[model samples]
Target: EMGHVLGIGTLWDTFGLLKDFPGPNPTFVGPGAMKEFGTLIGAGQPTPVPVANVGGAGSAGGHWRERVFGNELMSPTIGGPGNPLSRLTVASLGDLGYQVDLDAAEPYALPDPFVIAMAGGGETAPPRGVMLPTVPSSVPADRP
Candidate 1:
C-alpha cells in the first residue's frame, strides 16, 4: 500500500516547519468529487474521506481498496495485468500543493460496484495506465 501523510496539508506543514518552505497548504477538492469533470474551485476543500484504516496504520490496508478502485495505482493490490494511473491521484497532488500537468495525467473512471461480495468473485474493473510525475525543486524532497 502507498504510505503518505494523512492529507496533503499535513505534508505541506511538515515541510514548512522543517525546511522553511513557502506555498499553499494542500487541501481537498471539496467534501466530495465534483459533479463535472476537469474543474477546480476558487477555494480549496477538505481532504478526501480516507479509508477507515481501523486495525492499525501503514500496512497493506494503507491504500484505497482494489475492489473499489479496480486497477487504480493507489489500490493496495496490483493483481491485474494492467494498472491505471487515475486523475484523482493527480488532483490529490494538486491538493498537496504541487503544480500538476493535468494533461499528462492518465484518465480514470471511478468504479461503479452495485454489489461487493465478500469473495473475489465480482465485477471486473477497467484498465488504467501508470502515470508518474516529477516533483519540482520548489516542493519538498520525497521522504519516508
Candidate 2:
C-alpha cells in the first residue's frame, strides 16, 4: 500500500496564482525534489544545471570587443569626390540680354549694325550720383 505508506503531508499555506486545486497536489517541487524527479525520469547528466547568471563582468567586456572589431570604420567624408577649391564660385550671369547664333549652318547672315551700335554707345562710366543711392545719411530729405 504505497499510497497509505507514502508519508506525504501538506505543510504551511503558500500563496500562488492557482489556489482552487485539490490535496497533495503541489504546483511545483523544491530543487532537491526536482533532482530526485530527474533521477527517476532517467535523464542523464542531471540535465546540466544551468549556470545562474555566470560571467557577469566578463560578459560586459564582450560588447567592448564587438564595438572595437565588428563594426566598419567610416571615412570623414562619406560619399563622392572632394572639391579642390576652399570657396566655391557660383557664377550667376543674368540673362545675356541678347544671344547671337554665330554657328548657323546656312548662308551667313550679318548682325544688325544698329543693334551693335546701340550696345556700345551707352555711358562707359557710372553716373555722378552713383553713390547717392547708398548714402542714406547724406540724403536731401535728411538734411538740417
Candidate 3:
C-alpha cells in the first residue's frame, strides 16, 4: 500500500517513532502524530498512537492497531466500503521528515464504541477512497 511505500508504519522504529516493539503494547510516539491523535479522538492531551503487536511477523510491528484505529487506511484489516487516511496518519509523515500537507489527508474518526456495541459490533467505515487491499493471510516473500 502507499502507506508502506511512504514508510509510514515501516519506518517508525527507524525514525524513532515506535516504542516497545514486539511487546504486548507497542505504540507510536511521534510528536506530530501524538498531537493529532488527541484532537482526532477528542482527548485533552496528546496521546500515543497504538501500534499493532499481535498480527505476527509482517504485521504486528508495522501498523496502527486495528482495535483502536479500525478501518483507518493504515491499519491492517481493512474491511471497507471506504477508508479515510486520517490527519494522525499524515502528521506522522512529518515526523518522518516529509513536508506534508495535513489538509491533503482525508477525514476520519474512530468509531464510537458505544455505537458499535449498540449496533451489534459492526463497523461503519467513513466513505472516502475505495477499499485498500487486505493484508494477505501469508506474508509475502518480498517483504521483510
Candidate 4:
C-alpha cells in the first residue's frame, strides 16, 4: 500500500502545480515475476473477443451497476493512491487564462503539497499587466 501511495505522490510531485518540475517516472522492480503473474491470471480467463467488435451490442446494462453504485460513493474531495490531482480553479487575468491543478496525494505522503503559480497572456499585454518588468529609473544617473 505504501508503494502505491508513494507512486501517487511521485506522480503529483512531478506533474502537480509546478509543471516545470520533473521526475516521477516508474521503475519496474520485477519484470519477469510481474509478467509471470499476469500470464498465470490470463491463462484461465474467458475467451478473447475480436478487437473490432469487443463492445458488440447490448453492453448498456453492464454499465448500470457502475452508474448506480458509483454515484453513491462519489465524494467532493476523495484523495487516495489512484487519484493524484484535481483541477481546482480556472480564471482569467486581463487577457490571459490561468488554470490550477492541485496535488491530492495522501496526507502522509505529502503533508503539505507545494502551491505553484503560473501565468499566461495574449499576444499583446496579458489580462493582468506584466507581473514584474524592468523600469527606467526616474532619478537622473548623474544626480546620485
Full-model lDDT for every candidate:
0.43, 0.22, 0.83, 0.21
Model 2 regions lying over 4 Å from their true place: 1-8, 12-20, 23-27, 44-144
Give the per-residue lDDT of model 3 (tens digit) for 20-117.
Answer: 98798999999899999989778978899989876655678888887678778888777757888889899998989999999999989897777656
**lDDT accuracy of residue 66 in candidate 2:** 18
Task: Show the colliding residue pairs in model 1.
Answer: 83-128, 84-128, 84-129
Worst 10 residues of 4 by lDDT: 86-95
Candidate 4 lDDT, 11-96, residue by residue in tens: 32233212221222212112222232233235443221101111212211111111111111111122334432211111101001
The collision pairs in model 3 are none
RMSD of each: 19.2, 42.5, 13.6, 21.8
Q: Which one is best on lDDT? A: 3
Please give the ranking of all candidate structures by lDDT, highest first, separated by commas. 3, 1, 2, 4
Q: What lDDT would candidate 1 get against the real structure? A: 0.43
Q: Over the stretch 1-101, how does candidate 2's per-residue lDDT look in tens digits?
A: 11112211121013121121232222223233234224433564222111111123322211111111111111111124431111000000001112323
Displacement of residue 25 (Cα, Å) in model 1 is 24
Ranking by TM-score: 3, 1, 2, 4
